[model samples]
Every structure is written in structure tokens, then in C-alpha cells.
Target: MTSITIDLSDSQFRKLQDFARVHGIAIEVLLKASLEDWLNLQKGDFVNTADYVLMKNAELYRRLA
Candidate 1:
């Protein structure tokens, strides 16, 4: 694996460390999973189709009102 360096604010680093410990995972594992999830999100893996339908229904209601 390749190694890279990043800079995080104190609060962000603390939160990441806390989350890793609470989930019983290593910091590297947590970071990898988090990055994968973010990438998947960009790929539309976490689309909110339900919200779109609800918003359309709300527009219909507004038109009726």
C-alpha cells in the first residue's frame, strides 16, 4: 500500500480518533472505509430517490392549494 500524509484540524482529528475507538477499528481502517463510502456516494450509491418523490408530491399539493 502507498503512504500519504494529510493535515487535519485538532477537532477533526480528535473526532476521527474517537470514532475509530468507539467502533473498535484502527484509524487506518476507519479512514479507508470512510473514503470508500464517500467515493460510493459520488457514484450515486446513496441516492435519495424517496426524497425526490416526496418533493414532487409537495409541489403537487402546492399547485392544488
Candidate 2:
């Protein structure tokens, strides 16, 4: 219902175009499917980036703990 603008790099644009052509779908339909999948990602199923970084560097945090 709403229009949005996005700019993709040449590589990204080419990849999307190729993928849509391979699947025999319109670019708009492919984009809508991608957006819906992203919107439906389970928030609780993935760790936040910062939390993941801290977890990876847990040795440095040992002193604080």
C-alpha cells in the first residue's frame, strides 16, 4: 500500500534480477516475499549482535565477572 525507495549496488541489483528471472517471478513479487520472510523472523530465536560480540569476547569480560 505504501511506496518506498531503495538503491542497490550493481552487484546486488544484478543478483536480484538474475534470481527473479530464474524463478520466473516479477521483481516486485520477489521483493515482497523477501520482506515478508524478514518481517517474520523470530525475534527470540536469534541473539542480538552486541550480545553475540560480548559472548565471543567473553574472556575479556572475565575480569568484570
Root-mean-square deviation per candidate: 6.6, 5.9
- Model 1: per-residue lDDT, tens digit, 30-56? 999989899988767336676677687
True lDDT of residue 50, candidate 1: 61
| Clashing residue pairs in candidate 2 (N, C-alpha, C atoms within 3 angstroms) | none
- lDDT tens per residue, model 2, 1-65: 89999999999989999999999999889999988888767453465666788899999889878
**Candidate 2's TM-score:** 0.62
Model 2's number of clashes is: 0
Best-fitting candidate, measured by TM-score? 2
Cα error, residue 13 of model 1, in Å, equals 1.0
Segments of candidate 1 deviating more than 4 angstroms: 45-65
TM-score of each model, in listed order: 0.60, 0.62
lDDT value for model 2 = 0.87
Superposed on all Cα atoms, model 2 deviates from the true structure by an RMSD in Å of 5.9
Deviation of model 2 at 55, angstroms: 23
